[model samples]
Target: MSDFTREPFPDRIFEDLGGAFSMGCIGGFVTNFFKGMKYSSTKMEMLSSGMLFARRAAPSLGTSFALWGGTFSCFDCLMAKLRGKEDHWNAIFSGTATGGLLAIRGGLKTSLKSAMVGGILLTIIESVSIGINRKTIQTPRQQFKEYQRFVQMSENQDKKSRSELKLSEFK
Candidate 1:
């Protein structure tokens, strides 16, 4: 079978799960840090506050991560099946949908807000990542061509400046 038609490895799903879990842990820590600061003046108090917040945040964040990551991954698989490849649009839509659904507990207004934020954030992240990846993967010939173009432009600029200087000297 062609590479395009080949099935994805099942192990990737576990990888996604692990990644989501780690991200959730980090999110929980950051969230708890700020929360800890509000009520904690002393170092010891802050530490205890953080610990308490973390304990509470872990399960909620874990569930959020699982739902977000799992939904996005599933959407990616579906997109690949339909389009022969996945794209950023799929990620944005899936993230928005997941966020909105997760926020259903808070009501419609909250869900809409969450969806908008999630969609925009994911799109920005994915766009930046794609831009960076494209920049990093330049072919040697492409690099050489860009270098040559730079050199030619510099030469032209130098020639023009020299000519202008000579004209000034004559005047």
Candidate 2:
């Protein structure tokens, strides 16, 4: 039987970008269509304006998501190479860097804020992922060992600053 319930994360940049863009397109159109409903006076006006708004907004939203996804993928790959590992830290750093760089046009404060938020978000996601993994695929002893490993890595991070740490340290 094919297990089609869960989609695997894509390894390539274009796949990530396309998926992100398509998501943005659907979100933009659906949300804008409903938004257009609030101010529309007639059914005809509501329907037409809703579609018009969606048409105008979807491409821009898709493009914006594409940019974010592309940069995130690039940064993730770079971090993986530099750190000599594929782990949650790469996602966190990539998210933070992507957010900061994308928000640069808004000035230093905005960029810093975005970076912090992005990093925190990724941290939460990775933590949740670890928990889910723990639940799904291990005996009690193995699960405990994995949890210990996660804790040890986090503690090690506190001891060694990112720049000072060697790539081998991640392994």
User: Which candidate number maximizes TM-score?
Assistant: 2
Listed per candidate, the RMSD to the true structure in angstroms reads 9.3, 18.4
lDDT of 1 by residue, 83-108 (tens): 66566776777677777877889999
Residue 170 of model 1 has an lDDT of 100
With a 3 Å backbone cut-off (N, CA, C), the pairs that clash in candidate 1 are none
Candidate 2 local lDDT, 1-171, one digit each (tens): 122342334556777888889999999999988888766889879988888888889899989999999899889878876887677789899999998999999999999999998889888998998799777978889879999999999988877866466656776
Off by over 4 Å in 2: 1-11, 139-171
TM-score of each: 0.60, 0.72
Lowest summed lDDT window (length 10), candidate 1: 1-10
